[model samples]
Target: MGAATFNRRSFLKGALMAGAGVASGAMLSGCAPQSASDAAGSGSDGAAPMTADAYEKLTWSFEVPPEPVDESQITQTIADDFIVIGSGVSGLVAAASILGHGGSCTLFSAGTKAVSRGGSNHAVGTKTQKRLGLDYTPDTVAAHFNNEIARQGYRMDSRKWWKWINQSGEAMDWITDIMDKAGYTTTLELPFKDPNGTFSIPGGAHNFYGPEIQNSANDGEPLLTATLEQYILDNGGSITYNTKAEYLIRENDNTGRVSAVVATNADGDYVKYEGAKGIIMATGDFSGNPDMMAKYCSAFADYVADGAGDYDAEFQFGGLMPGDGQKMGLWVGAAWQNTTPSAPMIGWYGFPAPCSDQNHPGILLNVEGERFINEDTSSVYAGYAVSGQTEKKVFAVWDSDFAYRFDTWEALGNNMDNLGITPVTADEKAAEFEAGVEEKTYVKGETIDEVLQALAEQGGIDVEAAKATIIRYNDDVAAGNDTQYHKCKEYLIPIEKGPFYGQYNQLGPAQFLCVLGGLRTSPDCEVLDEANKPIEGLYNVGSMMGDTFGTFYNFRVPGQNLGMTCITFPYVLGKQLTGN
Candidate 1:
C-alpha cells in the first residue's frame, strides 16, 4: 500500500545474507523449517519462495493464472538474450537495439503490428530543429519540464528526468537513422505563437513524412514502424504476434531477479521464453480497464461516469490497450508511480476542419452557449479546457475571415524538405465549409443569426442564448477588450461577418491518447521492485513506464510526453543494455 523503501544498501544487505545462508548450507531467511531442499531453492519452480496464500494476496486488477505454469503441459518455444513484450514503439525500439548490438532477442505482441499512435515525438537539439533554425537546448527544455511537473502537483526525481533530457536528441538520431535507411523522411510539427511574440511551446514535434508530404492520414508512422519491424526480422530476431505475456518467471527462489517470461499464444498454447539479458514491458496503458481507471485515475473515472447518458462506446484515443504490462508488473511487487490521471489530449470531433487555431480568433461556447475558456490559448489548453467542460462538447463559431486570419504553419516552421504549409485562404476554407454543410457534415449560414439557428437545429445548441453570447462577444470586441474570458485583444475579433460558420467541437468523455506511468522505473528504465530496488532483468518503457512524469501531462511541451519519454527512453534503455 505504501511505496517500497529498498535501496542499493538494503538490497546489498539482503543479497549478502542470502549468499551467506547458501554458503553455510542453512535455511534462508523467511523460509520456514530450514530444509536442505529448501536451502537449495525454496519453491518447486526455483522462484523467490512464497506460500500459496502469499502469492494469492498479490494486489492486481486482473486474475493471475496460477504461476509456475506447467512447463510439461506447455512448450518452451524460444530462448534468447532478451525478451520484449508488446510491439509498440518501445518494444520495437528495444528489440531493434538488442539485435543491432549483435544480441539475440524475441519480441511478443498482442497485436499484429506496432501502432502509429502518438501525434508527434519530442526531442531537443534534433537535426531537424537545427535545419529548421529552431534553437532549443536540452537544459532549457528540462527546466521547463521540471517546472511543469511541479506545477501539476507531481514530483519527479530530477536525476531521472535529466537522464531522459540529455539522451533525447541521441534517441531521435537513432530512430531517424533507421527511418533514413528505410527511405522515410522525418518532419517537424511547428509551434504556435501569440500576437505579442510569445511562442506556444518550444517545438520538438518530429513526424515521419515518408516519401511524400501531404494532408492524408498516413503521416509517415506506418513507414517508420514497418522499417523497424523489418529490421528486427531481418536481423534474425524472433517476433511473435498475438502472444500475450502471462507471468514473469523469477530466478532461483524469487531472488528479485526476473529470468524468463511465460506467455500464451492465440491457440491457447503456453510458451516459455527465457532471456539471458532482460525482459522489457511495453504493453501500453490500462485506460480500457474501467476498474483500473476508477482506482487510479479519478478524472477519467468521472469522465466515463458522466458520459453514461451520451453514448455507450467509450472512445479510446489509441485503440484498445488493456494495461497487460501494468498488471504483470503489479503482480511482481513492482511499485506504481504517476498514478494520478493526466488530462487526455482530447480531440474535437464531428467537424472535418480543424478548430482551436490560435491565429483564427473564434468564440468557444459550452452546451449552454456560454464562453468557457480563452480560445486564444495554445491548442493543448483549448483541448484540455474543452475536455473538462460539461458534456465535453463546445462550439467554435467563426466568420468567413477565419482561414485568412489563420493561415500557414510558419510560426511552427518548415519541415526537413524545405516545405512550408501553403495557406488555405479564407475563401477556400469557406467553400469547403459550405460543401461540408451540403454533405450534412456541418452547419453554416449567410448570417450570424442564421448560423446560430442552424447550429441549434443541427447540434441542439441554445439558439437564442448563442445569439446573445455572440452579441456580447462582439460588443466586447468593439470595446477593444474581452472582459468575460480576458482573451488577447488581438484575437477579440467580432463574429458579425457574412457567411458565418458554427461547428460543433463535440467530444466524448476524456479519450486519453495514452495513459503514462505503471511500474516505477529508474533512469535506465529498469522496473523497480517493492524495495525501490531494480528487478534485475525487468525493464519498462513507453507508456508502461513511470517516474518520467508527475501528475498532469505537460501541454507546455506539446509532444514531450511521447517524444522525450516514450520514443527516447526506450532507445536509451536499449543502448544502456548494450553498454553503448
Candidate 2:
C-alpha cells in the first residue's frame, strides 16, 4: 500500500477543476517523521483487520491494485480516529479541523511538507467580506449562482452548489480566523469584468498575506496547506509524510464502513493505518495520470501539458496531478461522478494585450491575420476560442485610445464595481501598455501599417488580410455595428489612431491548469457509490469530490474549488465526524 497507484491499478477518477491555475501539490517525496522512519513509517506491525469485499464484481484496478502486499509486508498498524490520504489543502484542512475539534487525525501524504497552488479563495458572505465592506447578500449571491449554472447548461446539482454558497463564507471565515491569528492579511484579487456584462461575482475572495505567505506576481504560495499542516502537527494530530495511500479497507465487503487504509512509506514498507471513525481522500486531480486523463477527459488528454508522462517517478510538483485518490476510491465501491467529459481549469494568458486575459472586447486575429471569435466574451471563453485557433495563437489589436474607450480597465481579481476594490485609472492602463512596449510584447506604431509591420516581427501575421480586416472593422465601428460576430457595440473601438498597439499571444489546449470533479460526493463530503448511497466512513474533499462545477473554470469566482471543495466540505466533514 503506497501512493494510490490508481494511475496504474488506480482505476477511474473524475474530478474536473474550472480555474486555470493548478497547484502541482506533490508533497516532499520520501520525507517522513522520525517515528515513522523508525517504525518503518506509519506504525509498528499488523495489517488492518476488516470484513470481506462486498462488491466483488466491481473492477478493482485499471492495471492492478498491485495484488495487496503480503500480510507480512505490513510491518505495523497505526490506529487513529481519522486517517487522511493526502497532505494537500483539503487533507491538511480536514486534519486541522478534526484536531481543532479535539479529535485525533493521522495524515499520510505522498509528498514532502504541505503545499498548494494559487491564492484566490472565493467565499460569499464572511467576516472578511464584511471587513472589506463588500458584503453581498444571499439573494445577490443566489442570482449570481443561477447565472453561473445556466451558462454550464444547468448540469450542476443545486445541492452541491448550495452547499458551497450557503457554507463557503463560513468556511472562509473558519480558515480566516486561523490565518488572522497567525499574523496574516487579506485582500481582493483584481476583478476582470466580463465584457458582455453577462455575469459578475464578489471579487473579495480571501487573499492570504503576511511575511510567511510567499506570493509572486503571477502565482502565490498562500502557505495555506503548510499552515494547516503545522496546526495539525502542533495540536497532536499525527502525520506521516512520503507515504502514499495504496487502497482502502472496507468492512462487510462494500456494505460496511471504510475501516482502514494501507499505505506504503518512503522506505517501501507497507503500513496499515486504521481510522476507527473514518478515512478521507484528499488527493488532488487526475491530470497527471494519462489513463485517467484518457478515460475522464478524453478530448483534452493529449493537451494536458508535458509532465504527465513522468507523474509518479519524477513528479513535477505544482504541475503534475496524480489521481491516486479517485482511482483508489473506485476500487472500494466508490463511483465516479455522472458528469461526462469533465471540465478542465484552462486559461489564455494575454500578456501584450494590456487587458484582462479573460475579458477581451477588441479585435482579435490569428497568425494568418484572420479575424476569429466574437471577441466580446469573458477571458475564459476568449481563451477557449483561441485554444482552437491555428497553432493555438491570437493577436489583440488596439489603439493608444484604448484607455479612453472604457471608463475603467479590467484588473486581476479586484472588481471596480465592488465597494472595496480600487478602480483602475486610465493612466494606470496607459502605463501598462507602455510597459508592454518596453518589453517588446506590445509593438508601438506611428500608423496602423507600422503597427502591423511591428506585429509581423513579433509573430508572423498575414498583413494583407489583417489590413483589410482592420478596414472592415473600422467601417463596422463607424456604423456602430459588428457585421461578423456582432460583438458589443460599446467596446467596438475603431483601431484608426497612430501609436496603435497590438499583442501577440499564444494559447492552446496546453494551458490546462486544473481538472475539476471526480467522485460522487455528498454535501457532507461523503463519497457515494453508483447506487447513490453514501460509502460509510469514506469521504472526499478538494478536486477528489465531484459535481461541484459545470464548465470552464474561471477566475470569475476566483478560488471556487479551493474555497468550496478544499475548505467548505472539509469543515463540514470534520465537524460532523467529531461534533466539533
Candidate 3:
C-alpha cells in the first residue's frame, strides 16, 4: 500500500524505455523519461529523422534538455509522509503546515530555492485581518467572496467559496503570526483604501484602516520562503530544489489515489518519491504553456503566439504559468470550474517588457477611440475588456498633469509607483523626469490634441474619433462626472493641460505566474473528478483550484491569494491529512 512498494513494479518496467522512449513516455505518463537509443533508433540513417510519436511526446516535456542523461546519472531516493509539488507560496505553506502538524514531508520545486526573483511573492494582495484591529468578521469575508462570485453569475461552487472565506481570517492570523515569529513585522492594515466606496455586507460591516504591517520589499517572497524552508527542515522535513514532478503514480486505473510522484532532479536523474499518505499538486498556473492556455484559457487562446516552439518556455514559468497541474488534472478526468473569469489581477497592462507600465493608471481607448472601464480597475477586467474591443491593442493616453498628479496624488501615487512608476518625487527629481521622458520610458506630450494625435497615429486609433473622445472626457470631468465610463470623480480630472502622452498598449499575453481555471476541489482542498467525486489522498491548494474568485474581481483585498495559500488552506489541509 506504500507508494514505494506500489511503484517498484512500474519503475522496473519503465526502466526498459528509460533512455530510449523515456522522454516520449514521460510526456504521456506525465513523469517518464526517454532513452538515448530509443531516440537514435527512430532516426533515419543519421539524418536526424523526426518520429511522429517522439515529436508529439517531446512537445509535452515543455522544456527538455538537449540530451538525455546516461543511466549512470540515476541516483538516490528520498521518501516522505507527504510530497508537495512546487516551492512557491502554496507549496511552501503546505510543507510548513504538514511539518507543523507533525508529519515528515518532502518539498520539491522546479526552480532553485523558493524565491526565484519576480515569482509569485513579487506582488501580493492585502487583506484586513482581525489581529491588526481591522473589523473583518466571517460575515464580511463571506460577503466579499459572494461579491466576486456574483460577478461571475454564480459559476463557482458556493460551498468552496464559503469555505475559503470562512477560513480567510484564521489564515491571515496564522500567516501574520508566522511572519512575526520569523522576524518580520506583520501589519493588519490595508495598504490603500478603495477610492470607490466602502464595501458593505448585509449586516453592518465595520471599516477601519488597520495597522501597517512590514512592507514586503526585501522581506517579501524571499523572506517568506526562507522562513518556511527553515521551519520544514527544523521539523524533520526535507526539501529538494531544481526537481520536477513528472507524474503521479496511481493506485489503480479506477482509483484517484496517487501512490508516488516520479520526477527528475537537477542532475537529470530519475527518482521516485513515494507519498505514503497523498500528493498535493501545488504546481503553479498554466500561463506559460500557450498550448494549454489556448485550450483552457479563453482569454489567452487568441493572443498567445507560437514563438521558439518550446512548450516549457512557452508555458511553464514563461511569464504566465504552464498549467501543469491543470493539464494533469484534466488528463485524469478532473472537472474544471470558473473558466469564465480570468485572474482579477492579470491584465494586458501587466504584460512584461515592450509594453511595460501597462498596469499604471492611463486612459484606455478602443480602436475607434473611446474610453472604456477605469484603467485602475483589476488588470484581468481591463485585459478582458481590451480583448473584447475592436482590435487587440488598446491605447493608454495621458498628459503631463496626469503623470504629475499620479506622482503626488494621495490615493493614486502609491498605486502608480506599485505599477512600476519611477521618479518617486517631482521636486528635486525634475532632471530625472526629463531624462526619463527623453528616453521615451515615461511618455510625454506637449499638448492634449498633440498627444491624442500621436497616440491615434501610433496605436492605429481613428484620429478624429480619438480627438473627439478626449474632448468628451474633458467635458465630463469639468462637469464633475464620468457619464460615459463612470470612472471615479477624483480620476475624472480634465485633461486640458499641455504635454500629453500616449503608449501603444497591447494585451499582455502571458508573462508567467498566471491565474487560469483549475480543478474542482472540496472546501477541505480535496481534488474532485469530473463527476464531482473526491480523489482521496490528493489535495489541491493555491491556484490549482479554480472558482475561488468566482466570476469577477470584486473589491481589492490585498494578500488574499497569498494569505489563503500560505496560511489558511495549508493549515486546513494539514489537519485534514493528519486527522487532527
Highest lDDT, which number?
Answer: 2
lDDT of 3 at 496: 70
Candidate 1 residue 425 Cα shift, in angstroms, is 2.8
- Who wins the TM-score comparison? 2
Every model's TM-score: 0.81, 0.82, 0.72
RMSD of each: 11.7, 11.1, 10.4
What value does the lDDT take at residue 576 in candidate 1? 74
lDDT scores of the candidates, listed in order: 0.64, 0.69, 0.56
Give candidate 1 regions above 4 Å deviation.
Answer: 1-68, 139-147, 154-158, 196-199, 212-218, 252-255, 302-319, 348-360, 407-423, 509-511
Model 3 misplacement above 4 A: 1-77, 116-132, 140-142, 188-219, 254-256, 302-318, 330-333, 338-345, 348-363, 373-380, 403-436, 481-483, 486-488, 510-513, 552-555
Task: Kindly provide the TM-score of model 2 when superposed on the true structure, using C-alpha atoms.
Answer: 0.82
Q: Which has the higher lDDT value, candidate number 1 or candidate number 3?
A: 1
Give me candidate 1's TM-score against the actual structure.
0.81
Clashes of each: 10, 42, 37
**Can you write out model 1's per-residue Cα lDDT over 232-271, one digit (the tens) per residue?**
9999988888787888887766665888888888898899
Model 2 local distance difference test score: 0.69
Candidate 3 lDDT over residue span 1-580, tens digit each:
1221112233222222424444313344444444435644533333233455544444344332223334365476667788888777678788888888777788887767764222222112224233334445664345565565676577766676566566655555566567667675443222444356432212111111112322232224455667778888888888888887665666677375766766788888788878888888888665545445433454544344334222223112223456666666655556676455454334233321111222344467888887767664554456667767776677766555554554432221122213212224444334444565687644567876666666666667887888888888878778887777677765565667666556666654343235534788777787787778887677788766776665543324444555554457776788668776
Residue 44: error of model 2 in Å?
60
Estimate the lDDT of model 1: 0.64
Report how far residue 95 has shifted in candidate 3, in Å: 1.2
